[model samples]
Target chain A: MTVTCPDLSVEIAGLHLQNPVMSASGTFGYGVEYEPYLDLSQLGAIVTKAVTLEPREGNPQPRVRETPAGMLNAIGLQNPGAEVFIDDKLPALQRFGVPVIVNISGRSVEEFARLAEMLSIDGVDALEVNISCPNVQEEGMTFGVDCDMTGRLTEAVCAATDLPVIVKLSPNVTDITVIARAAEQAGADALSLINTLLGMSIDVERRLPHLGNVTGGLSGPAVRPVAVRMIYEVARAVDLPLIGMGGVMNAGDALELILAGATGVAVGTANFVEPAAMHQVIDGIAAYCRRHDVARIADLVGAVAADQA
Target chain B: MPRATAILRHREEVVSGHYLLTLDCPEVAKAAQPGQFVHLRIGDGTDPLLRRPFSILLAQPETGEVQILVRTVGRGTGIIATHDEGVAYDLLGPLGNGWEAPAGGEDVVLVAGGIGVAPLIFFADGLRLMERQPYVRSIFGAANQEALVCWTEFAARCDEFTAVTEDGSAGETGLVTDVLAPELERDRPQHVYACGPDGMLAAVARICRDAGVPCYVSMEQWMGCGVGACLGCAVPASAGGYVRVCADGPVFDATEIDWERMKRR
Candidate 1:
C-alpha cells in the first residue's frame, strides 16, 4: 500500500518539470496565490499571470460570467507589469521546487522583447508568450492571427532571452497551423496552443452585457473541442514540443492533448471550478498509466492516427 | 489535521440537481469539522477544467468516507455528477474554517435555505455528541416543499423545526426569516449559525446584529481557484478589507461581513 511518486516528469524547452501538471496562466496568478491551499512543490511548474511591459488594472468589474458549457472572462491581462513581476514575483517563485514560466503580453514587438529581456532573470525557467489577449487594442489579437506578425514577435522574443520561449496561440483563428508554423520557423523552442476563444454574454433583463467589458474570451469545458482540434492542427504543422490546453480537467483530457501532439498540458478554467484539479489530473495520469501497463506517459504523445496525410 | 491520502471512491446522483460524492479519506473525516469543504476535481475525461468546491455534508470516521453534496451550477459540477463510480478523483481539503459552537449554557440556532442545510446537519451532530443538550432550533426556507431536502434528518435533531416556503407550497407562508423572528424571541439563543442564498444570509446577519446575537454565516462566491489562487471569490468585510471565501472563510462572523457590499443589485 506504499505509493511512490510517478515519474511524470517532462522537459519542455530545456526546462525540467517534476511532472506535466501545470496551472494555466490566467487561472494561476504568479504562483504565489495558491500556496496556502496546496503545496506548490507538487506541481510541474507555475505559469505566472499574463504580464505586459507596463502595469495593467485589467477590464472593469463583472470580468467573468458563467456560460452554458464554459465561462467568459475579460481580465485584460491584469498584472503589475514586467518590471514589477521580476522585482517582486519571480524571486518568490524561485523558492518553490518547480520552474516558473512567465506569461507575457505586449502592445508591440519591442514591448514583448523588452518584457522578455526583463524576465531573463536567474529564477525564471521559461517564457509563455500570451498573444491571445483580445482587450488590448494594439498587440494581442492582432499579432497572434497573422503568421508574419507572429513570426516577427516570436523571433524578437526568442532573441531577447536564453530562457526557453513558448508561443501560446489564439484559438480565434481559422488556420491555427499557420501561426504555429510561423512560431517554429521564428525559433520558438516550444508551442502552447489554444488560448480562450473570443465570445461574449448579454443580460437580457438589463439590456446590457453580462460582463463589464462587453466581450471576453470563452474558456472552460465549452472550449475543449475547439482546443483539441486546434492542438491537433498545430501538431501536424509543427515539429516543436507543444503544450496543449483549454478545458483540460482530467487525465484523459490531458491525454487527448498529448495525442494531438502536445508534450504537456495546462489546466485553465478547471482551476476556478476546482482548485485541486491539477493534482487530480496528475494522479489520474499515473492511474491511467498503471491501468494500461504503460511504462511512460510520453509514449502516448502523437499516438493518434494521422488522417489527411 | 491529519492529511489522509483520500481518493475519489464514488460519485452518485442523489437529488434531482444534486450529487453525492464519497472520498475515501479516514484522517480527513476524523479531523474535519462541520462546515468545512473539500475542493474536488470533477471529471476523469477532462473537458471542463477546474475543481468545484462542495460542503463536507457528512464524514463517517469508521467508514473512512467523506461526503460532498454538490448542486450542479456549472460545467465542473456537471462533469463530476456524470462520473462513473469507483473512478479516482484528486481532493484537497477539510479546508476553510468551520463554525465553532458556543460555550456551555448557550443555545445554538441553525438557519438554512435549501441546500444550505448540508453543513448545518453536521453542526447539529457535533452539538448532540458533546452532551451540551444545546437548545437546538432550526428554521429552513426553500423554493417549495420538494426543494426542502433532508428536513426530517435535521428536525429530528432539533428541539423545534420551522419550515418556510416562498410560494406557500409547504410549511408556513412567507420567508424562513419570518419564521425565525418569532422563534428567536421564544428561544433567545445566544449564538446563531446560518448558510443559504446571499440574500438570506444577509438578512440573517442584519437580524442577528439588531438582536445583539452573534452569528456565523457561510458565504458562497464564484470561485476561480477554490484554494485562493485566482482571487475570484473575494467577499468584502466589515473591517474595510476583502477576505477570500475559499481561504479566509466560507464561514465568517455575520456582524464582521460588509452586508451592503455583498448585495448585488
Candidate 2:
C-alpha cells in the first residue's frame, strides 16, 4: 500500500487554492515585500491591501499603537490608487506563481463597482471587497454596518466583475450574521469575516489619543476569540465559503478558525511579529493532518463536534 | 534577511530610563547598514504581541554582535529593560533603508536628541571606516546631562562634538538646534543626517533647507511590519501623499517630508 500526502488544497467558490493559509490584506503588501523572507508560492493566495479610486495619503502620523496582546491601526487605506496598483504592483505580484486577490474599498456603491471593473485584468485572480476599513472617516465601515447597504454594494461589485468576489465583513455591527447572510444573498462568491473591531487607546501622559485617528481597528491574539465566535455564527448562517481572520498568530489559531467553520484562514497581525508566519501555519496544518491521520485538510473544516460546541 | 535568535551578550542601564542591549547575532550584524533597524520580540509570550522596532545602534559584523539603545517609554520597552544577560531575543532585520553617505571628504553633520542618538552612532562609525574622513560634527541634546548618551562614542568618530542640555548641565544650555543654526551660517556642511524627536528633526530640516544644505532624517513611527507591507509607518511626503517609513525610508531627504504635518503627531 502506498502512503499518499495529505491534500491541503481548498476551493473557495471558484478560486482553487493550493492550501488554506494566505496572508491577510494590509498585512501582506502586494506579495512582493515578503519575497525576501518567505516563498509567496508556498501559501494559498496573496491578498493585496485595499486599493482606492485615487492616491490617498491616509491618516496623519501615529497611525498605529500596540496594546496588550494586540495592536490598533488607523492606516486610512493609503494606496497609489487603482491604476498605479495595476501598472506597478500587479505585474510583480503575478510573477509569484500564486493567485493574487486584490482588495478594494470605496466610499460608495458606484466606486466599488468602478474598482471591481477596473481590477478585472488577467493577472488578478479574485477581488476581496473591503467594506470594513475602520480607519477611514467616511464610507469605509458605513456600507458594512447596514445589511441593505452591504447587499447592495456586494451586488454592485459582483455585477461589475467576472472574477470571484469575496466580501470582507466588519465585526463592528450589532449582529455579524445578518450582514454575512446579506453578502451571500447579494451574489458574493465567498465571505471574509471579522475585519478588526474598532478600538482606541489614550496616552495619559500626553492627554491625547494613541492613534492619529481617534479609533483604529484592533487586531492580534486579543481579537482571536471574537473572530472565532463571529466565524462560527456566520458559518452556520450562510452557505457561502468563509475566509476567517482576526489575530491568527500560528497554526493552532488557524485551526481554531477552520474548526469553527472557516474554509480558509488568513494570517494578519502574526506577519508583523514573524514575517514567515504564514508558511509556519501551512506546515503546522500539514503536521496536524498527519498526526490525526486526516486524509485531507478540507475534512477539518466545520468539523467541530456538538459536544465540543 | 534571515531571522535569528540572538543571545543577549550585554545589558546595561546607560541612563535613568535608557538601556543598551548588545546581542550576539552574526546573521543580522553582517547584513546591517547604518540606519537600518531590528524588530525585537520582547518575550516568549504573546501579551505584548507585536515586535518593537529599535534602530541598530552598533553593528560589529566581525565580532557577530549588534547593539540596540532602548529608552524605557512603555510596557514593551520596560519589559525589555528588565531582561538580564544570556536572554535570547527573536530578531528580524536589518530591515528598511539606511543612510547613504555623501562622497568622501565632504563636510558631514549629525544631529541627535535623547534616544535618537542610537542610529547616528552607527552612521558615525561607518564614516570612520572610510579611507577619507569627512569633517564630522555632531550635536546631541537631552533634557539634562544625565539623559545624554553616547557622547564619548560620538566624540571619537566626530571631529567636533557638541552636547546640549535643557538645564545647562552639559556642553551648552539650550537646544541642539541653537548650535545648528549658527554652525550652518558659519560654514554649511555638505550633508546633515539627523535622528531625534520629531521637533528636533523638523528644526534641522528647516535649517538645512534655508542653508541650501541637503538633509537626511531618520523618522520614527509606530511600526507594524518593519517591511513595507503594513503601511503603519506612513509619513506625509512634502510633494504629496504618504510614504512608508519602513520601506521608502527610516532615513529620508529632509525636503521629502512635510515637516509641519510630521510635528503634529
Candidate 3:
C-alpha cells in the first residue's frame, strides 16, 4: 500500500523543526554522543545536557537509581563549561540537519546572560534556559520556584541575545502557571514544561539515600500524568508556545502532551533505555497522523476534549 | 553499535547463583571484544526501568553468538538469570574499550574474583591462540569453591593456576593478593589483568603497584546509558576529575584509578 507521508513539521520560537519530537535536556548528552545508535536528522530539535559558566565536577558516585517504571538522577549539571562547549562540542552538532537547542544553567542572572550571548553564534537555533540551578545571589533560591526571579532571569536572557529564548519550568513548584506567565510577560519567546519532578529514594538495608546527592529529579513513564496536567494548565494560561516533556517513551505519550496544548514533545529518560526511542516516536507520530487523517501535526495542539459529557 | 533484538539461544545455571546466557546476535558477536560490555534490557517492558551492563564473556563471530556471565547479586541479575530461551531481548553491544594484548615473548598473569572471571576467560582464550605467546598464570578467588566462576576455563587455558577462597573451599584459604604478592617475587610476570569486587581490585592494584607490574582492571557500576551519554557510571580518576566507566575504560590501567576513593564506596 502506497500511503503518502503526513507532515510532522513544527515551529518553536521562530525556529522551524522537521517534526514535533525532540530530545529533552539532561537525558541527551550533547547530541553527538548518541550518533551510533540514532540518526540526528530525524529529530525536531536536539536539546543538549545543561552547561554552566565553568566546568562542574557533578555529584559524587551513585548518581542514578532505577525506580518503578522510572529513574532518578543527580548529575549536578556536569559539563565542560561554555567556552569549551562552543569550541569542542558545538562544532560537531553543526553538521546535523536538526535545530540545536543549547540548555544552560547559571549561578546568577549575569552568568545566564553571558552564556546566552556566548552561544549566539551560528548553528545554535535557540536556547533552553535551565533555571533549576540555585541563584547564589538570593542565598540559593531556585529561579523557577519564584515568579519574580523567573521573570527577571527571562528578561535578562531575552535581552542578551537575538536567538529565541525558551524558558524550561520545574515541576516542583506549587503552581507552575504562575511561573509560566512570568516568563511570558518577561518576553520569553516560548516555554517548555516540565523539567524532572523532585524526588528521592533510599535503601533500607544501608540506611542511606540511593543517590550520593541525597535527592534527584525523577523522569520516565511515571511522570506522564503530571506533564499532561501541567501542559494543559499552562497552555490555557499563556499564549506562548509550549514544548511538553515528561516520561515520554512512545508516540502515544507524545500525542497526549500535544493534545493537551503542546506545540512540541521532547523525549527524556527513554533515550537511556533505548537510544532509538525518539525515531520510533517520530515514525509513530507520522503514522498516527495518517491513521487519523490529520495533515499538519501542529493542528493537534490543545485538542483535548473539555466536555465532561 | 546496533541495538538489536537478539534471541536467547541458551541459558544455564553454572553453579548456585551464577548463570551463563548465550544470545544469537551476529552483529554484536562479530564486533565484540573482550573487556567490552553490553547494555541489555531485561524484557520488552518498562517495569525493570534501566538496561543492565554485562561483561562480554565470550563472542564467537563464526557461530553468530555471544556469552555473558551473571551472578544473581540483586533483583536485576535475578530477573536476567531466569530469562526464557528463544525470546528476543533488546541488546546494545561491543561497547567500551577492551584489554590490550601483550606482544610476543612476554609472561602475563590474570586474576578473577567471583564472576569477574568472565572477561579474563575470553582474554586467556585469545592469548592461547597466539603462537608466539609464552607462560601464562592465573588466580581465581571467591567466598567459596562453588562461587568460583569459570575456574575450569582458567585451569585449562593457563600454564599455571591457583584458587583461593575466604572459606577455604578450593585450593588455598587466603586472599588472592596473598598468592599474588609472592608470585610477583617468584615469577615477576610482565603484564597483569585483574577484575573483581572493589576491595579486591584495590588490593590487587596495590600489590601490582609495589611489585612494579603493570596491571589493568575491569570496573562495574550501575549505569543509565552505557553509550557514554548519561554520565551516570562515573569513577574517580587519580588525575583529578571523574571518568566514565562505560566510555573511558571498563578496562583501565590500575594506576589511572583512585583506589583510595573507590574503597570508600
| Chain A superposition TM-score per model | 0.95, 0.98, 0.96
Greater lDDT among 1 and 2 belongs to 2
lDDT of 2 by residue, A153-194 (tens): 999999999999999999999999999999999999999978
Q: Which is superior by DockQ, 1 or 3? A: 3
lDDT of 3 by residue, B1-265 (tens): 5677788989999898888998998888888888988888887677788999999888899998999898887778888877889978788887899998888668998999888999998888888888797578999998899988778977788899999999998889988998899999998999989988878899999999999999999988789998888888888889877889999989999999988776345
TM-score of chain B of 2: 0.97
The regions of model 3 sitting more than 4 angstroms off are A1-3, A133-141, B263-265
For model 2, which pairs clash? none
TM-score (chain B only), all candidates: 0.92, 0.97, 0.97
For model 2, the stretches where C-alpha displacement exceeds 4 angstroms are A1-4, A307-309
TM-score for each model: 0.71, 0.97, 0.96
- Fraction of true contacts retained by every candidate, in order, equals 0.28, 0.90, 0.68
| Model 3 lDDT tens row, A42-61 | 78999998888889777777
lDDT: which candidate is best?
2
Candidate 1 per-residue C-alpha lDDT over A113-207 given as tens digits, one digit per residue, 9 for 90 to 100: 99899889788889999887776677788989999999999999999999999999998888898889999999999998788888988878778
